[model samples]
Every structure is written in structure tokens, then in C-alpha cells.
Target: MSPQTCTEGFAYDRRARQCIDVDECRTLPDACRGDMRCVNQNGGYLCIPRTYSDTSCILGYTLAEDGTCNDIDECETNSHHCNPTQVCINTAGGYTCSCTEGYWLIGGQCQDIDECRYGYCQQLCANVPGSYSCSCNPGFILNPDSRTCLDVNECEDEPCSHRCFNTYGSFMCNCDEGFELAADGTSCIDLDECSFSEFLCQHRCVNAPGSFSCICPPGYYVYEDGRSCEDINECDTGNNTCTTAQVCFNFQGGYTCLDPLQCHSPYIEVSDNQCMCSAENPACRDKPFTILYRHMDLSSGRSVPADIFQMQATTRYPGAFYIFQIKSGNEGREFYMRQTSNVSATLILARPIKGPREVVLDLEMVTVNNVINFRGSSIIRLTIFVSEHPF
Candidate 1:
């Protein structure tokens, strides 16, 4: 039995000089299942089942009855070491940790995420532990979507009394033409147009509620242009108070009276600004004067024959011309006269006199003869009284 070889699963013992069983499980603890026990047999070994309690499992492993330590799915068994806001993932021997929504895993702990860093809000953003909110500035408001801001309408309430204008975050007041906004900014006040020198008023300016009017002084009237003033012609309108013998001349702001009376051969200038019959001249005494009276019936609206006044003048020189006219006292408009020739005429009352009245007719006669180279004139004044009763 010296140096004899043994078969598989057997060993030779030199002292005993025979084949023996080899307990491979005792030398190699990992030769069988982790939960199984190793037993020696004849030339072989056996793996027997072992028992273990729940505590026998490691932190991330489960214990089996064969006394084996297996990998445990802590994610599925709800036995992970992660926070409530963390996600668990099953690994080979343990579970991996990750942060949930709105949170971040930092330094092995869940921390609040700053959503503002991602521009979550249009204007302003506030971050919480796990969420975020949006807000607006002073003159704006949050939109319904909670992510944007909108401007407010300040003119909706109609702040101005006259006119209101809406701005970005406020309101403004305005006024119409010829008006101005008051100090309160809501009311409107009148603008004094007359106070400005740029106002074009020819004469005077009168201020009103919201406008101005131009005024003209006496003897002047506003022109058709409504701004300038023009001189009024009293002679054309027959509004002058001057007598018929006086001529009316219009000036800038007034009128002038011109006396047309002139003294001739048989007449002299009187202190009353008139031409009178000269007592020293014999032709003045025979000034071709004639007077007659007339009557009328008021009830019948009929008048008697007109009064006749005649004057005849004969010159020895040929080409002698005679002229006849009334000098004054014709403004009453109640009397009329027609001259049949240069020296003969008739005077009549236009209507019946309502009461007793006296009428004076001043007549003048002038003669010019080139043959005799002489010019002569005469004046005749006649007075007539008209009584309401028959007279």
C-alpha cells in the first residue's frame, strides 16, 4: 500500500494506508447553496437545508430556510431608506434613491427646488418647498392663467367731467376748443379769449362763456367779416339829424354837416347862417313874392284847390334865364309844390292838418343874362296858418 492513488471524491491517508471520504463543504463554505448545510458522506458531500429567522436577513437582503442571504427588493417591499418625496429603485443588493416632483436630492436629503430659475412666471415667481406661484407688479394684476400679468383700465369709471383719456396705468382729462381744464383736473373752465393779444378784434373785444365778441364804437358797425369794424355812412341811410339844407359828410367815426347857403346880388348873409333879402336893394323888395291859402275836409278826405304862388320876371336882354327853388322849411314832408315855369309855381298840402299848424316857405329866385353880364337873386318868405275848423 505504499504510494497508492485514490479515485475521484476520495483521498488517501498515509497513516491508515486506505481511501477516505473528502468533506469538500467543510473546506469550501461556498461549495453549496447559501441557505443549505454541507454534510460529509462516503467519498462525497451532501448539501442539507438549514433554518433562519426574519432577523437573520441583512439590511438589504432576505433570509431563506436554507440559511442563505438573497437580494431583497426594498422598492417593492416598501422598506427603502428614502424620504416620502423621493423615488425608490430596486438594485442588485439595495435600492437607489431619487427626488420626486418639485424636489431635488442634495446631500442625501430632499430639498425644495427653485422653479423661478426656469422662468416659470412672466413677472414674479415665488418658490415653496415643492411648488411655485406667480404674481404681478404695482400697476398690474395677475392673469387667470397664473403665469402672466395684465394692465388695468383706469378710464372705465369716467374720472373726468368733460373728457377722459386712458393711459397705461392712469387717466387724463381734456377740454374742448375755447375751454381749459380746471385745477381739479376733472372740471372744465372757460378760456378768456379777450385776454390774449393775438385775438384779432378791430375795435373792442368782449369775453363770454367760452368765446369772445368784437364790438364797434359809435358811428361804426361790424363788417361782414365779423372781425373788423367799418365806418357807417349816415347820409346813405338817411339817419343823420342834420337839416335838408345841410349836407352830411361821412368821416371815420362821425359825420360832418355842410351848409350850402350862398348870398347873391339881391341877398345878404344873415347871422343865422342863411341868405336873407337885402333891404337896401330895390330888387329885393319886389322879390316876386305871392301867397295864397287852402282848406280841406277831414271827414271826406278831400282837399280844396291848392294855393297858387306866382312870380314873373322880364329882362330886356335876350338869353336871360330864371331859376326858382325853396330855401328851407321843407322837412315836414306835409307840403308839395310844382313850378309851372321858372318863376311861377303852386304849393299844396299833402293831407288834411289834424290841428292848427303854421307853415313857412322860404323861396329864392336867381337870374343869369350873358348879354347884360349881370346875375341877380331874390328871397321871398311866406307864412300860412291852417286851422282845424274852417278858416
Candidate 2:
């Protein structure tokens, strides 16, 4: 057996019994220098330069002192083929092209990646040239981590007029016990307890800021409970003005001073509180058949259009019809009478009277029957004393 030697780039193959060409590009680590392409020949290899613009050495490469090729940094020399919008990365004997952040290279061109499509933000996302940002929804704020969303405490800014409560990602405004939220939802207003129901007070209802109060009328006071009322006995309290000729009469809500004397002439005394016109006297033609005396006390600033009194006719005859009118003492048109039925009439105060003032009204009711050809009239002397204060 004999061993055969082959030239460089040629190897002896015993199985083939002949010399085979060597693939120097795969076998030798430094076969291709400075990005040069290695080419194999019949008995040798060649280092073909990828670029060749240099006079003494291949482009993107330099001739070292030892006669070997050293890669040249084209990026530092600014000789790379990359455009100004691209980045130049230096390589052995050449340079690579790269785009800035958020851009990708495709077919030697830089394209933008729509990061917003990936849904990086909880509410909104914006994609920039090379980066992306995340944002939160309303009533929320971005956390320090830049990706998490946290609730914004709007209550901290004191946006509510009364009480503010904070919730997850939102806030709410609430009113106090006697207040209500306004249309704007942040401001609070008085609930107006008086307007809600008439039963809120036994006498009168007054509304205040964030609260309400119930007040009693004249001759009465608010009871131990805030809304109920209790009548005051003016006689027992010595709150009456009774002259020596008159006696004090106690009533449910007031006192009366009545004289025990008889009625004046032309007005014959009929009963304890009534007087009649004598038919024999000529003045009786214009006088009412009966006259009655009544008294009432009112608090100042009472609400108007109040039906303060009702008068009922003594006659209940089937053929009777009635006419009612305010005959006298309505100087300012303050009083009017409404005929409620054939036998009943009501006195309405049309105008508000400021006190302390006394009002005396003569309201008359006339009964008529055409079939009987008879007509009779009666009058009520209503004396109303308005107090200076509202109870």
C-alpha cells in the first residue's frame, strides 16, 4: 500500500481512489477575508472582494502592515449606502442597513408598525414613528407603571356642594338630610318641605335652608312635637282686653268681649248674638232682617285667597235661592263672598293685609223665592283682628 500527496485545495479520497477538490469556503475559517467571497478552483481557492473601490485595498477593507486585510468601519467614514433616515451598522468589509425604533425593514425599506393595533392601553393608544404611548379613560389616570389604569378621585377636588363620595373610576355627589341635588347634580338646594304635602304642619309650614319648620297660627302655639299645634286660652293667660261693661268669653283659640247690654234702637235684640230690624220703623225697609256678630284673629302675612269664614242660612225651604255679596268694609277690594250653595256662603280674603290692623266686613246673604214672591236678607258683622306677628 502506498500514500499519495495532493496539492493545496485538493484532498486524497481512498474510497474513490483519486484526489478530490477541497471546499475551502467550508473547511477554512478565514478562507474568505473581510466579507470576501471564496471561490474554489480545480487545485486552489480564491478570496473575491465584495466591494472594490479602493486603490490599494478592497473597499470597506484596509491593507494591514502584515499584508492581511482588516475590515474598515464605513459607518465612521460615512461611506455606507444607508440613507439619512436609516442607521448604518458597521460589519466586516461592509455595513448593514437598519431603521430607527418602531420601524421594521422589509425588502430594503423601513415600514411603520402600528402598535395601537395590539391594544396596549386600557382606553386609548397612540403609535409614534419609533415608539408608542398608552392613555386612560375619563375619570381615570395612568399609573406609574405606564400600563396600568387607576381611578381618579374627583372628590379630592371638592366638586360637590354638599358631600362627595368617591367610587371606582367615578365619583358621586350627595345632599344632606333636608336638601336635594340640583339639576347640575353637584349643587344642593333646599327641599321645600312645605311644597311636598299639606299635612306636614298642623297650622303652617315654613322652609329654610337645608331644613323646615312648622309654625302655629294666631291663638295657638307649636306643641311639644315640632309639627303639631296646641290652642292657647287667652282668658286664662289674662291676654284679653275686657272693659267693665263687657265680660270675657273663652273660645277654642281666642277670647271675646261681649257687653250684656241690649241692642241699640231700630235694631231690636233677638238673641245673645243677633239683632232684628223692627218692621214698624221706616228704616226697616232697608235694614236686614237679622244681624249677627262674629270675631276672628289672624296672623300677619297670612296667605291670600283664604276662605276664612262660612255662613249658613237658617232657612232650608225647598223653593229658596240665595245671593251673597260683600256689602261693606271692603274698601280695598280685600274681601269677596262666594255662594257655595242655596243656603251657604263663604268669605274669601283676596288681598293680604299687613298687621296689626283691624278689618270689619259686612257680608250679606239674601234668600228669594219667585213662587212665594218673598225675599229676605241677613247680614254678618265679621270682625277680624290681624296680629303683628306670624306664629
Candidate 3:
């Protein structure tokens, strides 16, 4: 078959079945630069420089090669064309990057590691994104062996002289030669053994501060240290130790014997403390009596005459009588009294006046009226005493 040719200005061969693409720029060698790429299409081949192709152009440039991106090199135009934390890498059709160590790759970027926020371990453990740590257990210390933890033995050495107490991770020793523990458990010192002695008959004994003893006279059995001497129970002591009048009460280092009738509640305590009395021992009795007092007021506009009189009421107790009598005075008044069989007494005034009236009563009751006003501003006074027997 012969080379096929197009119509119009170019000649055509009737016998040829294929048509070859014709190079439009056969004369030019470097037809496309680094920024441009050439592509071939139907009818007539099209030449699009890489600068015009979207796949070869810079990130901000548009596509010119029929909108088809054949390849892309992100690192060329922007260096780190994506995120600063990512490594810019070029690909055949696109560009991408990833975060490096110490940073986690997220959506399209890198994030910091929040080691302290997670509560990483018990006791104490420091966390560093890609690393972590642990702590020593209680009663133990961090051991360099295998870089782990180990226990400490407190009782390994003899720390106390009298008593040895071993606690977790530690131990203590105490002394027994009349010595007691000091404030600290690891040491001991002499105790005051002589202060508690009760016996008054001791002649001589080496009195250690923490203990003491009584030395008895001849013919007397000596009691143990710090205790008083009592006749030893001869029946058990292999000697006749008790007297016929005494009963024995034995205690540490000593004993006591006394006659049964001689024992009594000591009354000495009564003289030292206050005397307490109750209903069973009444201290005093209450007196039977009644209290008496009267209240009175003068009318604002009423005045009593120079001399006026009126009768007043009275009050009586079951076993007593009270009486009121009007006395003579413009301001001062007096009460009169008389004994009667009736519990109550009444007195009538000898003089009477229609104007304001001045009156005084010796009992608790009073009778008032609008016409009985006082011509002079004055108050009525009542004075009375109770008599138990009425005659």
C-alpha cells in the first residue's frame, strides 16, 4: 500500500488504505520545553506545549492539553506545595506528602503528641508520644539490676537491743536489761524503775528509778520490791504468818489484813466535797402567803373637790378579809380597818358631793362612774393587808 494523502492542497492516492500523521514542524527539533508536552489526536495531530498542559503546568495554572493531566511534579513549583510538616513527593498523575517522626499525620497535616494529658500510668510514668515509663512499687526502691525495682530489708541488721519489730521494708530491736524503748524504735535506754514504791517500812533497797522495794525490820517477813510488808500467810509460807484478828488480801509484792468490822465507808471525803441534799433530805419548806398591789389613773379632764368621799368595793380570800375606808385629804388618802366574821368588809362615806369625788379604799375592788369624776386631777389609792382569820 502507498502512503495515504489528504485532499485539498495535498494529493491523495486512490489505492492506499492507511493515512499517516504528518509532522507539522519537521524542521524544528526542540519543539516542546520542560514546561510543555505534546499530544497526538485524530484528523490532524495537535501540538500543546507542557506550559499549556494542565498536568505539566504549575499548581495555579489551568489545563491546555484537552483538560487531561498526564503527570504532575508538586516539588518543582512550590517545594513543599502542601503542608510545611509534610515531605513533598512527586507522582505520575498527582502530588502528595506525609508527616515525619514526633508528629502524627492528620487529615492533611501533622499534630503534636499530648503526652501528659492521657494519664499514662499508675504511680508515676512519663509518656513521650512514641515512648513511656513506669514507677517502683511501695516498700521497694528502683533497682539498677535489670533496670527494675527491688525490696529493702529493714531487719537485716540487729537494730534494737530488747524488742525487735519487723515492718514492711524495715525492722527494729528493743532492749530488756531494765531498759525501755526510746521515741525511736531502733534504740533502747534504762527505765525509771524506783518511783512506784508503796511501802513506808522499807529500811534500805537500791532504788532504781523505774522500780523500788521496802526493807522490813527484824522478826518481820520482807515483801518484794515496791510493795508494803504484811504478815505472810504462814499456812502457805511454811511459817505461822497470820494473826487471829486479821483477814488477808494478797497483792503483787505485798498483802493486807484487817478486822472485818473495822472496814467502813470512809467519811473523810464528806469534809472535802460539797454537801448535796435532795427531796429525800429537804433543806427548807415554802411559806403560804399572797401578794397585794393596786393600779389607778386620774381622768385627764376630771378633778376632785377640795373635800369629797365615796364608797369602794373589796376582795376576800377564803380564810381572810380585806376592807377599804375613805380618808380626808385633797391629794393624800388613808385606809381604815375593822375585823368581821364575813371574809369581806364594806364602808360607806359620811359626806357626799355631786362634783368630782376623791376616795381611797383598803381592799382590792373598785366601783367607778362618769358622775364620780374628780374636780381636781387626782388618782384613787387602795392599801390593804390580808388577815388569815376573820372575826
Q: Each model's TM-score, in the order given?
A: 0.41, 0.47, 0.27
User: Which residue pairs collide, candidate 2?
Assistant: none
Cα lDDT computed for each candidate against the true fold: 0.64, 0.77, 0.40
- Winner on lDDT (1 vs 3): 1
- Sorting all predicted structures by lDDT, with the top scorer first, yields 2, 1, 3
- Pairs in clash, predicted candidate 1: 35-66, 35-67, 35-68
**What's every prediction's RMSD, in angstroms?**
24.0, 14.1, 32.1
Q: Candidate 3 residues 1-391, lDDT tens each?
A: 1223343222232332222223433434655555545443222234575444544543323355686544444478674456776665454333445334444444545565444456544345566654556565565666554235566665556566556767655565767766777888667766755543433334445555444455643324565644444333434553444577655433222333434332122211122111222223332112101112232222212223312224322332333333333333323332233323343333322222221232335232222233543111111334222111110
* Ranking of all candidate structures by their TM-score, best first: 2, 1, 3
Using lDDT as the yardstick, the better of models 2 and 3 is 2
Quote the lDDT for 149 in model 1. Answer: 86
Predicted structure 1: clash tally: 3
Error of 2 at 275 (Å): 23
